[model samples]
Target: MHVAVLGAGYAGLSTARRLESRLPPEVDLTVVNDGPDHVLVHEVHRAVRRPAVADAITIPLSDVLDRATVVDARVESVDAEAGRADLDAGETLSWEYGALCLGSETAYYGIDGLSERATPLKSLSDAAAIRERFLALCDAGGGQVVVGGAGLSGVQVAGELTALAEERGLAVPDDIEVVLVEQLEEVAPNFPANFRRAVREELTDRGVDVRTGTTVERVTDGGVETDAGPLAYDQLVWTGGITGDDATGGDRPTVRADLRLTDRTFALGDAARAVDADGEPVPASASAAIRMGKTAAENVGRLVDHELNGSADEFDPRLERYRFDVPGWLVSVGDGAVAQIGPTVLRGTAARASKTTVGAGYLTSVGAVHNAVNLAEEELL
Candidate 1:
């Protein structure tokens, strides 16, 4: 009667929180994460500019959960069929039911020297490293700062670099050239056209040299080799893409609407390539991950009930299905933001407000009331 939830990102934490209310008091619940805290990954980019912001976004698991026992260990691999997960600490975790929400790692796409040369923006340490390196470059009289990705993370970090340059009294393009490279024809390539346009406009307005359709072929100590040409940079940050966790191995494995990897194991968030009820692929975003986690929690709860009740039914219990129906998209560009709701796209104050609200709302939902207030004050006021 033990249930295990792996990883402490948005998906894993959300699932664990929901399971606490759904499961019986006798059932044992455990959460395995590499760290003691659940990081608000979507807001980690803000830490690149303001290191103090990390305090508000990193919530200790103890503060958020009451009944679940938190196990701070790295998940090495999961054998869903056997209901077992191997940990880096040389211990095995066995459970009756499990959820795999191990999140993702940066994907270098096998680009030569890229992994060695480029710093990724996936963790708090990564953000701190990026800030330190960028500041050093600025102190050395500035050079080109290239971000090899134009996705939301890429765009946000690039914007932050520009904003940081201004704060240091450096002339943006003249003193510190911030370049955003993307293989696609535009930034935010997968987003709606209007949202894409708004993001590009914001980047441009902030003095970012947006280079669309520019693919990175290789990375050297001096600079990057691209389809366009070689571009020298003092510092490089990669937000290009993500792959499945090492525990899951390879690219993200596909999971259906039920979010099940096996009869008793569920996978959600960046840990799996998840699809909605209609078979539409779900994008890797915090909003989508939270929804998928809750959906999987419901299914897991139903399975727990069915098994504990000793029903003689031959068939499995009906499970809840997940649907990717997010209402809108929001992204922050330096001090500016953009939001797209249905057919309408918003910018300036409206979009900034939406961005602030979403971040603060997520914090509040996770019972981080003081953190939520701090975030609102830092971003809006």
Candidate 2:
């Protein structure tokens, strides 16, 4: 029996690792993805200004997988019913069991020129480009820096940009603003109100010009055109929203309740539209993706054995459903401060510690135990 898992993001990597340790030795497994490294997505916001962080946040796939073939390829599409995947290199491979773990892409919410003008923070390359752009703007002297979408990404970018400006000794005139524009009244809307308040206060205290309850009409080369007005900027970083990228991930034909796409195929992570026990759609986050990946891996193990047993009993597709409770949110607010946890919020150095601990916990959970420890050391020191 053989299985193929697509993507190397949160969902894909966790599922592959689970199978590597759980699947029978006779079963062959392969993990296919475009990148050579697994990006720690939650840390990507910090990586926008700190290039070295990209290295720490990404781990080589070879070092993490012991019993799976890691294929580095840009996936084009998958014929789920046919159990075959086509790659950008004009090669197609067939698998008995295939899993789709393709993650999401930066979502531009129909804002004119936003996609064309703003730099998104969803990928390592995107983060690096933001850093380079900021540096270039600094070298050119100084000007306003505006951030669109005051979500977690926006707040982090604003904080990091402020810090970077100081480090580079760039003149940030009082009139030359560092602004964050959000459509919502509150910042970090995903978190609780208390946490949101803490985050707002922190950003305000850190010298960020917060513009809540504001709508962006478009993004221009100079700056974002908002309902308020056209604000000038030398550089802009967009930590806006996200949307599904079907070009790389497979389109949904029909996903079984057991998490399988076809007889031997599966889909997990942001790429998979998994319905929970209540039939409610799961929120797209790293937490949900990690859980889905583990469940898919377990079901894959069962299918591998079932194939070998040859009992002729059809696979019980419903055995693949997974439901769990996990609600922990954390956001960095510059100056070594953070807002975190569920309803309970932390601030100052204590909040920062919580944020660091949470990051370490994720790395360890994803089977990068040593990397988790190393990252903690680097982050703390």
Candidate 3:
């Protein structure tokens, strides 16, 4: 029996790896990915300033998968009904059983010209491009900069920009500014109020202009036109938001619970619209993607087994309910940090240390133990 997995992001890779480890020897597993390496997405923001981080965040696909066949091709079309995917090379891939981990794309929010003018921080290339623009601004001494969105990515980028500016010992010109814009009245809207306050303080302390309850009305070659006014910017970074694979205008119903698109077809990670068994939506996060991957793999195993043995009685258990609330969140603001776990709020070096530990812990949990150690060592020294 053949099991095909598409996409190699956290959700897809995690599912593919789990299936590789547990499935029977008779199962033929194939993982289709557009890229040769799995890019650690969370670190992309930091990579904007720390170029060395780029190498540490990407892992070659070959190093991780032992038995699965890796197909290096971009999926152009997915015929879920026919259990097939059309490749960019005019080839067709068919599968008896498959998983879709298409992941999400950036949500432009319909802002006129923003998609063409702003550098989005979605992929490694996007991060690198932003880094270039940031450094250019830094080298030119000063310029008006705008970071759209106050979500996790926006907060991080704003912080990193602050750090970068300080490192250059550069003072903003009378006309130059670094502003963060958010539609909500408050920044970091998902985090607790206390956490949001801490972040605002951190940004304020670092001299970033934080604006809330504002929307980008339009974007042009010079800058973003906001509801507040025309904000001129030499560099514009978009950390706005993202939507599921359906953003491509595909007709696949926004993925169901259990991460399955149809019988024998599953969608996991950002590509899938993750929802609970009760049909409630789950917040999109890396943690959710990883869990969905494992769950999808287990269910795929059951499909393979039932087909092989004709045992209708032994179907894999129903997909488990996934509920998550980040008890605490951490954000690095230049050399310091703002962290909250439960009601315990921390700032300064303690918070910075916590941020470092969290980063190391995630690396280790994702089977990047060696990289984790290297990171820890770097931070310690």
| Per-candidate local distance difference test | 0.92, 0.77, 0.79
Candidate 1 structure lDDT: 0.92
Q: What's each prediction's TM-score? A: 0.98, 0.89, 0.90
Model 2 TM-score, all chains together: 0.89
Models ranked on lDDT? 1, 3, 2
Which residue runs of candidate 3 sit more than 4 Å off their true CA positions? 172-176, 245-253, 277-280, 312-317, 325-327, 377-380
- The numbered model that scores best in lDDT is 1
Candidate 1's displacement at residue 67, Å, is 0.8
Residue 169 CA error for candidate 3 (Å)?
Answer: 1.6
Candidate 1: where are CA atoms >4 Å away?
none
lDDT of 1 by residue, 183-298 (tens): 99999998889999999999999999999999999999988999999999889999999998888775588999999989889999988989899989998988899999899899
- Model 2: per-residue Cα lDDT over 1-381, one tens digit each: 678888888889889999998888888888888978898887887776667666667888987888899889987887777878888779887787777888877778788888888888888788788888887778777678888888777888888887777778864445335789888888887666887888888888878899998888887678677888888878777777766666544343334346766666787676766767666666567877788888889888777777777853875534567774466666776555665565677788887888888888887776677778877776687
Q: Estimate, for each residue in 270-350, the C-alpha lDDT of model 3 and write its tens digit.
A: 675666766677666676777787778877886777677877566554553444445677887766689898898899888
Weakest lDDT window of 10 consecutive positions for candidate 1: 311-320
Supply candidate 1's per-residue lDDT for 197. 97
Candidate 2 residues lying further than 4 Å off, grouped into runs, are: 170-176, 246-263, 311-317, 365-370
